[model samples]
Target chain A: MQNDTPELPIFPLILSHAMRPLPLWPLSAGLSRLAGHILHRHPGINNRIDYYQDHVFLLDITDLPLFLTLEPRKARLRAFRRSAVVPGHDAGISGPLAAFLAMLHGQEDGDTLFFSGALAIDGDTAAVLALRNALDDAELDLAAELAELLPPIAGLLRAGLPGMQHLTGLCLQRGSAASERAW
Target chain B: MELVCPAGTPAALRAAVDAGAHSVYCGFADATNARNFPGLNFSRAELEAAIDHAHARGAKVLVAINTFPTAGEEAIWHAALADAARLGADAIILADPGLLAHAAERHPGLRLHLSVQAAAANPDAINLYARHFGIRRVVLPRVLSVEEIAAINREIDIETEVFVFGGLCVMAEGRCALSSYATGQSPNMNGVCSPPDHVAYTSEGDDTVARLGGFAIHRTPRGAPAPYPTLCKGCFVSGERQGHVFEDAVSLDASRLIPALARAGVSALKIEGRQRSRAYVAQIVSAFRAVTDALAAGREPPALALARLAEGQAATTGAYAKRWR
Candidate 1:
């Protein structure tokens, strides 16, 4: 019989649409594809942020003043011991992970916040808390623009909402916070 | 079944004992304890008294030297173990492979119970620890199902203690990076997750922004109660989602599952949150004591008497129900 199936979409477009159904998806490939898109757009962040080994992001804590690494697939983290140059894409926080990062800068400026549940965390539960303390040496307030991301970029995230919700549910549900309003 | 309760200070040990804790766990006020907060935990002098106090009550004191020691500073951990033994602790809760090995050799008769930080999720790993380091009791990770727990119980000769109430750790210990990327220090070494000092909430226009370690974890209405910007529970913008990708802000309460856990043959019930008040600890210990007592007597737990103690006034059975991926 003659083949009549639709050919696979172009690699670039396919890469553009790649998404992990799991909430904590690996940032390596997704971030690489994101790098591809960023290279298509601004390109400078790729120069500032290195990305080679399994999606590592080095935050320019000196220039922008925050060093952060996120592993979406696993709900844990590894905090750098000191402020130094490391060869990895440092994910500079201009978004959600920002305020708590400021708390790591060492001021009791944060609010009456709740934890997801006493039990649920992504990667290393202890490491997550330690990383927060490591950043607790200074007071923080990210650049205003980075605090609330611009609408155009926000649209990109909103477009991928369902997949994000499903993945987050996978990551946190059995978590104490799963009983919270949104879960 | 045993009741493993928290004792942040020497005095808390007395309270936990007076409140009827079967065994109490406390940590050094340094990086050694998972509750490595300032002004919490016991000093060497305090430990001597606390151990003495628990001993007087005929209860056991399990020193929690659980956080992974710094790569080269294993000596700090070793000294803590020596001190615990010197002061007469009933057992030590350990997580690190090297430390467990060290304790097994250095303090052979100290009675070791593996910490949840060890993340022993299966029989093979549990057996490895048991065989390698002579671990007598294993605190199973929060990832196992009751059926899994029962199955592990059947195979392992040692006792198994699963976390029954208080905070739940959905992810394995020593594996996450969400906080470190934002701040620099994290739990595996620092013994905290989303440390309170790194948490901030700011008002911008109509939205409230919650940040942890310089990362904005959530954005809610200005007056709404913002959950702590814990990386896992915080809201984020990913692909098409703009909500908590890991979990929302809530605390774990597993009272309803006590009967199931008892059937699974668990040796003890662990309560999280050592930084909580003595009143909080006493309340939870008493409540669980009642539940376990009733479970021991083959009766049902009393109606929800400890509901208000949880963060966000919510609770879960966690993975003991076994639905997590």
Candidate 2:
């Protein structure tokens, strides 16, 4: 069978390399500030945060090698990049970049990923449940927020966002066809 | 015949009970049950409350610990049964023979309902379970026709339950390894089939494709609804027929056959969506309750007002009719 491996563009590879050396603290601080403002808009979330008092969550995007420690106890939520001292988090959820994004945006159900072994969670499950419930109730639009953060790439991101699903579908179709032909 | 409804959470259990379900079935929040999805099932505290609530309202609560146990981990399934008995479950639904034997020996007073996951299609298998483990009820596999079911009923003294509505599994229950082949996790061991984490949907050009474990299972035009890519109900190439080879992305809607099923000596009718929301649970349970009520009244069953609730906007009687065979 002819090799049908979908070649990934070099951009993400370059970006991933460049992101490794860059200081993530500033970005994490900025995002946490934004989360504070957003949390105030959803009182239900503010109340749910109290249930997770002092509980910190490590959200690891395993595919991208990036991690964020989320503190959800205070009036405003805070996101911090992983540091050596951030070892004993109350809970940690790790998944592929796409599955995490899909779950965050409510496009995909969390149970689907967990059931499919796409996502892994460790530590306090109750803390994870509280955070999931709060986020679901708030319905935060991360895409819109990212667009606001990067105005020049806003249109490009919006265009690329819709294509993610299509691209995923295309890759699978091509891959399956290749495997079947090989058989 | 009784109406057995599914409940994912305590709220859904209440909704099912309020909607007139004669019995509400649910499972613990772990891999012990088939619908072991996130944010579903009941914690111990919640199950106690739910059972209390259902019992007070004249509805029985059946605890489903139906998934087959993994090798070297039979104790987990046993512990679940012990907890169910301690919690006053009206009956325990089970699929594993070893677990059934343990339940029979350990908790003799607890009622046993053989899970559909057991795939007990014929009278011999059904009777074996009834006789050896004292299983009082058996949920028949979906592969059998009504006539086959009637024949089985004539031969087996145990009560039988049948799925009347909700999602359809093309493969025989307890016998499907497709999900495991694709995702390394299966309904039998992990209690999840077509797990969402392994599913990916992407758009390419003007079409959207649904993939499971890197295999394309379905493709739809942009703006068209893409069904969940369960392996059996997927579009595939077979010779020259490149369409749904096994079954379409339609749900089981046997609401029209309640009378026939009742006549076939089916002891209960089951609705099959524990992953659904409380509103969905209430609506479906209420609709099925109406059908059973109409049959009891000696009147024609009401028209099914549940097309909107079915998967992919379509429903079929599945293998219940001979032509589907």
Candidate 3:
């Protein structure tokens, strides 16, 4: 009676199925909305970059197959996913997830990241500098903002999204063990 | 032991109180507090509200007007202490000897605690502060071992408070002029250490370099975390060695030594992060509350879950144990 539970399914298959319908475009769109909402709440950020209204910057997350293009629109900054049809960005910044996350959350120093070469910027250095100054002026917490955006799952993702990763890892390990038993 | 917590803002003060802080310490939005960081600290109205909030929860508020008085600006420090009294602070923490004397005379009824910035390491200094200015407690500098602390407690009549967690200053509390040498901002005077205005960072090939006052303090490889531009925690080159010369970028975490500190006759446990956010204050205060509550219940303290939040992802017992020396 105690051992009547069903075995866990394979994590890779479940993840694949879950992510298959939701491609990078939609995911990027959702992220852009979230970023826009956060940026909109802090008007000081926009004021810092008011001079760079014409510049569009692309943030390329090297670890993840995603990029966000940020530009000023209608007196407020808006972020959108990069696509073939989209106009070329004034500057393109590339770095690992940590660097981008740190910069986004106002946790890491952009100057330090660029100086140490942890992040790379191409096309327009002045645009990137403006972006950095604006970000520094806005000390936004990405995790907190994400939590606010999704109140129901706020507690589940404290200190960033590591909880989801841990849960996925646990599911994967259990699935692998079940696979071994079947063999 | 009483758990004294730091609150740089009104929100942080409420967080600390809600998290079971026995007492919450804060400073005005001026140079009176040691953590004189930009966008930090409270206004007079904020402190009044904070005090009311803490008092409603059975927690106390201690105002720290602990910065050293400048040559001609003695009136400001005196006014800070007087205002602390006028604001009905449970206690006022002071560092400068002249300020302490002024507070003792001007506000005779106000409780006075010696700030760690005073660096009263020996019993002689502690006794003098207690005798001359009626200091109720002395926040011992983060330089002594548990045994040394116990020895000092045995001789001094005043209560002893020791920093149990948060940032570690390698230099003796009040004596350090490192920040002044590098950035011309005095920690003891300006209430700022490694002021953010002078800090800068740059990317060099595959590493991230953190600069304070145009000097490279830390340069971490790509993807690795770069240390905050702290002068003392900077990587240096000397005699073919290139590493954190003065001290590693580690936060003080003496949670494991709560019992030892209690045994050493420590009256209170101080956490050193007034410049931190409300979320950080809440988490740390609640965690330390559990530890102190466990100690009171005669149970083992919980495993430390705070290492992840520490600077450089590392925590140490600091000078509490013999290992530091």
Candidate 4:
């Protein structure tokens, strides 16, 4: 069988490296806005993660030189440079960006990723589980969400998503698309 | 033999059916089911669609209202039973005696399969349930050996189902209160165990500690693959014994014992993990389907490398071989 180990693409690594010295405030603001838009679009996500309203989660994208802390109650997401002092978090989920995206798009199973050592969770297992389940139920399509955010790029995004997914082995949509892929 | 697969959501139900599950079992979104985790399980309308989807493909849909009903909340369980019957479920897997009596009396036409949570391991208990509630099948708990199961099957009149894969409960089902003691919720009462909300992990120097209800369960080195902090599988210290005390953090995989279980007159093989993803459901269902189909055709069952799906990336036969003594 082929190696199912997730590998980070060189493009993201290069981009991450280039952004290592840049200020993260603008990126943090954009991420917070995107999170707000998601919450606005899918109100039920709030209820699903209600137990974690006060909890803070650190999302560490291992392949990228970025760290994100999400505060669900405030609908805020803060981005930090990899070299910056790590912010305190109640729970943490560390993984490659592809694995995170794959999980987000329902392209991979969270437990399967964890068992395969593609993902490492620390601090609060329950909180992370709740967030994963909430996202799974929401079935958030990041491509679509972004397209909706910028209608001018909607068609371009919709057309490019499949190719991007193919190139990256990332799941950009929800449904049984992952079932067709080899384990 | 039948292949019963778990479906935590409607998508997973379809995945299981599409992957060739003979029957798919799911639960209502409420606490009526054992896998009542946040954002998991099916709504009533979803179940309706899921049942239609399964039935169209020649697969049966089993609804699990297995959790014991709270004293004042029996009506909720009753309503779930009513909805499941109204939704054309193939059968309802239940555990509570009162709930079983309610189902048998009110929905007599709805086939009833005893849940593993009932822990009906012996002939007398299975016979009693069969006699009292007219149950058609009994899902034996994970604590029985193949010889013990075969022996029980000899004296029982009803069909028997045994867990073939997925999570293994170290204690007798329905009787354990460890999770409730730690987290104030349990599979029997609240349809959850060591609920995620009560669990937390912390980085203490080079070790990451997993705690349940504030009691540390596991402390693994940084970057090591850590298991979920289920109380039964946790590490403990008992007089200089600083290791897993109750059970190892391993999932049950009886794929190699399909032939023996078939010989034991087991009517069905059940896979656990309703909280799993559709990807998991599809993969596991197809693997088991291949095994059972091969067994039926007298062909050698293919070896399945499913360790990546097992808890702690390890598998065990549990009490099936009575090796844990």
Candidate with top TM-score is 4
Instruction: Encode model 4's per-residue lDDT on B1-325: one tens digit a residue.
Output: 8999988766677778878999999988787887777767777887888888888889999999998888898999999999999999999999999999998899889999999888888999999999999999999989989999999999999999999898888788856688878877666766556677787767799977888898899987765666667888898998987888888888899999989999999999999988887778888999999999999899999999887777777788888885764
- For A67-106, candidate 3 gives per-residue lDDT tens digits of 5577754332333333334436777687765566555443
- The TM-score ranking, best first, is 4, 3, 2, 1
Q: On residues B104-200, what C-alpha lDDT tens digit does candidate 1 reach at each position? A: 9988888999988888888899999999999999998887888989999999899999787766566776566777777677677766666755655
Point out where model 3 deviates above 4 Å: A1-183, B323-325
Which candidate number has the best lDDT?
4
User: Best-fitting candidate, measured by DockQ?
Assistant: 4
In terms of lDDT, which candidate is stronger, 3 or 4? 4
Q: Per-residue lDDT of A65-139 in model 4, one digit per residue for the tens?
A: 889999987889998877788889988998888778877877678887875557878776767877877776566
lDDT at residue B128 of model 3 (Cα atoms): 91
Ranking by DockQ: 4, 3, 2, 1
What are the clashing pairs of model 4? A123-B201
Candidate 3 per-residue lDDT over residues B1-325, each given as its tens digit: 8999988656567667877999999998666777765545667777887888888789999999888887898887777887778888999999989888888888889999999888899999999999999999999999899999999999999899999888887677756677887887777876556665566655689876667777888777655644546788788997998987788777789999999999989999999877555555667888999999999999999977676555555678888884543
DockQ for every model, please. 0.02, 0.03, 0.06, 0.35
Candidates' chain A TM-scores = 0.23, 0.68, 0.65, 0.85
Clash counts per candidate, in order, are 92, 8, 16, 1
lDDT of 2 by residue, A60-164 (tens): 766453577777655333333334444457777776666555545434445445433455566665566556645543445665656666689889877886675
Residue clash pairs of candidate 2: A112-B197, A165-B202, A165-B203, A166-B202, A166-B203, A166-B204, A167-B203, A169-B202
Which ten contiguous residues of candidate 4 chain A have the minimum total lDDT?
A1-10
- Model 1 chain B: worst 10 consecutive residues (lDDT sum): B220-229
